[model samples]
Target: MKRIIPLLIFCFLLAGSGCANKAQSGAGIGALAGATIGALTFKNKASGAAIGAGIGALMGYIVGNEWDKYDEKQVSQTLEANQSGQTSSWTNPDTGKSYSAVPSPAYMKQGQVCRDVTITEDGGEQILAKACRDEDGVWRLQQ
Candidate 1:
């Protein structure tokens, strides 16, 4: 219970960051999960949490990186295809995690094309994200 309090506080602090990227979010969530599991499983909570956090961060980074790529691709394709209100889904074969994205209509912002997308994960987590086209014609998440 004491450990959980600190983790909750950490998460609240993390949430206060306005422009958190995927890796940061992943690391924070992963660390929290790792610490909880470690505290419950090991006699030495501190050591377990340290080891678990490291492993969790690594795994989270890899997974989050892949998800970022996948999102970019999906968003780009949706924009190019001009298919607003369409739902596209994909499943990672390695992890068996499924994801879906529904893009809103594309609009112009400061002469740049932008879109809002609602992404849903297999476990029902959802995030609303904004993506914009760069000068190089590549779509990137808006900070």
Candidate 2:
């Protein structure tokens, strides 16, 4: 059917998009699911799909952002406990994604304690990340 072709294409695109990041992956998945539901639930399939996709994307972004926060928390904890050059590792219970971080020595930046870290994901790509501890002693990832 005509509808089936587009849906299949969308799914393929979604699969590729998921590789980007959690927020993006969530949006792609949400849009696909929303479009399917909207097409089935509404008389005007096109309009319904559009509206549903928008709503779904927003919701998905929120959920995905939370996941990001959770990951950041883990990274912060690792930085707090491990010594410089010692790798700290953890696996996310929710996503089964594993990460390891090796933090550099703590240094002062603009009066805040900061550390540079190398974080490896699933033993594959490694990303350099930075985190700083505030007065309240919470370690926050620096952009």
Candidate 3:
């Protein structure tokens, strides 16, 4: 019962925070996953859960903090509203990371609008991505 109380408190805090972005959501997911893994892998379930939660939260924060709604909007607007050669750029106020996206001309694929784009992050890292417009008219990045 005592162990459950701490976990409940943790969950309550996570829920109360509103989890307005990916980082918060990641932390919540990581905490749950870590707790499960820790319980299965260690003799001291509570201690293991605590350690796992810490590690997982850090990892999740790092991964999920990379992008947010602003970044998504920048990419989508650049692809949908501009010409092939046009580029769009934005800087994240919280992280100080700058991003730029350049998109190729849109083409039709299986009744969907598709485009290829190159995104530069922090002025050095670059990623090539493909995106397609869905039935709801939202552009989604392809895996």
Candidate 4:
């Protein structure tokens, strides 16, 4: 039964991502399936429901968190791509006007690339932005 619960949850999670429905709904469906299987296999409906709920919540949390993080990384990568060494005078895409940003020591890599930097704008100052060598070897900020 324990083994079955994991396999069931794995299938549900995969199915959920491939599916275009709501996360809570998908998790609820998985939990229902888990509970049904557990009760039938072990003859304990209460325990089965508890176990099903716990496993469902865990899987849902992981999938939700990973999806959010993946989005953030992509946006960060895009910003880093667009602003690498274009010049001291770069306009922030967010504000349209120029902002001052300076690359920290992190930007200086002997061989590897520096990227995903954030800049604060000020009066007439040259702003530094995050920049990276894109996969194509050309440095772009909005990759």
Choose the strongest candidate by lDDT.
2
Residue-wise C-alpha lDDT for candidate 4, range 1-143, written one tens digit per residue: 56556755665565455332234544655565656655666557667756766676567555544543443344344444445433233453433544433333335455647664444444553323445565666444432
Error at 124, model 1, angstroms: 3.2
Summarize candidate 1's per-residue lDDT along 1-143 as a digit string, tens digits. 55556764574456345455566667677766776677678798777776676676667667767766765686677666657888888776655778888889889999999999887879597888888889998888776
Deviation in angstroms for 113 in model 1?
0.8
* Model 1 Cα shift for residue 138 (angstroms): 1.1
Clashing pairs in model 3, backbone N/Cα/C closer than 3 A: none
| Candidates in order: C-alpha RMSD to true structure | 5.1, 4.5, 9.3, 12.0
Report backbone clashes per prediction. 0, 0, 0, 11
Per-model C-alpha lDDT, please?
0.72, 0.78, 0.76, 0.50
TM-score attained by model 3: 0.61
Off by over 4 Å in 2: 1-21
Q: Where in model 1 is the C-alpha error above 4 Å?
A: 1-22, 29-63
Q: What is the lDDT of residue 113 in candidate 2?
A: 97
Top candidate (TM-score)? 2
TM-score of 2: 0.72
Q: In candidate 1, where is summed lDDT lowest over 10 consecutive residues?
A: 11-20
Ranking by lDDT: 2, 3, 1, 4
Model 4 poorest 10 in a row by lDDT: 85-94
**Model 3, 1-143: lDDT tens per residue?**
36744874674477346423567666766776676677668798777777777677667666666656667778888888878978888897766789999999888989999999998988896888899999999998786
Residue 44's lDDT in candidate 4: 72
